[model samples]
Target: MQLDRIDYALLDALRKNARLPNKTLAEKVGVAPSTALERVRRLRESGMIQGYHAEIDPQALGIGLQAMISVRLERHARTDVAAFDTYLKTLPEVLSFWHVAGGNDFLVHVAVRDSQRLRDFALDAFTTRKEVAHIETNLIFSFQRNARLPAPPRD
Candidate 1:
């Protein structure tokens, strides 16, 4: 869908606070409340806006440790990759996973309660996978930008 300045303004307002009332959004974007509501609906329908979620502090939630794991698979065959991807989805501690272009086949974001739990995850879970050949783990010290919207693509 082609987005004009109004649509971009609407998106920016929603990104700041998804729970903002339609009236407030309209005021911020200088549009009618109904227009703001309809624009949001269209954005959602077009898959531009995926979903809204409440951000929670992991430390407060008892998940104090975060790690970025680079996983190298023994074999990069299609079936093997699919099986590994499916297996990753089954692990709750595996918060997010990405398929990358370089040496590592997958990059995974994992969070756990503490250091011990993190170690257990690496040894007991990650290492034991049949298709996993090598793994490198990095402990996250502090996050600079935790979450931010992706910038619109360049023309």
Candidate 2:
């Protein structure tokens, strides 16, 4: 589905604050509340709009330290990979992980209480795993997010 200026406006506005009221969203996008609601529903049905979520601060939740881990798996076999992927979900400290291209198999983002726990986690989690070949860790002293998408391509 082709998105017009109004659709782009709605997307930008909603991503900035998903909790925008129908009336407010309509005004911001220069449309009637009903139209805005209908457009949003269509966006969801078309898979343009995925889902809405609140942005929670890790620090506010008492997670003080954050790190990014580059993981190289020893084996690329499906079973080995599946087992490793399954094991990752069981780690509470892991925030997110992505299977990517390049020198590493996966990039994992984790948040913990401090450096000591991070070291322990690295050893107990990846270092001890047989399928894990190597790990490169980077400490994150700060983090930021801008969920806003760039302007849509001009067609």
Candidate 3:
């Protein structure tokens, strides 16, 4: 869908707080509640609004540390590569994983209670796999999210 100013306004409002009711959203975007609801529906149907989720405090949930594991696998075959990707998803500590072109084949974001668990994950989960050639784990001191894009300059 081609987004007009109103669509951008609605998206910005939703990004700020997805829990906002249609009534409040409409008020913020200067539209009727029904219109806001329809627009939201259309946005979802068009795949512009992927999904809504709450931002939780991992620390409060007993997760004290975050780490990124850069994994380089020896596997060159497609089947083996796919199997590794699927296996990564089953690991509880894995928050996200990316397949990228670099010295590392995969970059994995993980969260654990402490450094010991991180070490355990690297040794037990990754090193045990014969296909995994090299693994580097880095402790994350700070993490930030760019939740929304800045609006285009006014014409």
Q: Score every model by TM-score.
A: 0.92, 0.93, 0.90
Error of 2 at 127 (Å): 1.4
Q: Point to the candidate with the largest lDDT.
A: 2
Q: Write the per-residue lDDT of candidate 3 for residues 7-113, one digit (tens) a residue.
A: 88899999989999999999999999999999999999999999999897789999999999999989767876797899999998889999888898899999999
lDDT of each: 0.89, 0.93, 0.90
lDDT comparison, 2 vs 3, better candidate: 2
Clashing pairs in 3: none
Clashing pairs in 2: none
Query: What lDDT score goes with residue 53 in model 2?
Result: 85
Candidate 3 regions exceeding 4 Å error are 150-155
Candidate 2: list runs displaced more than 4 Å: none
Candidate 1 vs 3: which has more TM-score: 1
Candidate order by lDDT, decreasing, is 2, 3, 1
lDDT of 2 by residue, 1-155 (tens): 99999999999999999999999999998999999999999999999999998787888988899999999999888888889889999999999999887999999999999899999999999999999999999999778788788979888
Give the clash count for model 2: 0
lDDT tens digits by residue: candidate 1, 1-155: 88877788888888788899999999999989999999999999999999998877789989999999999999999888999899899998998899887899999999999999998999987799999999999999987652455566655
Global Cα lDDT for candidate 2? 0.93
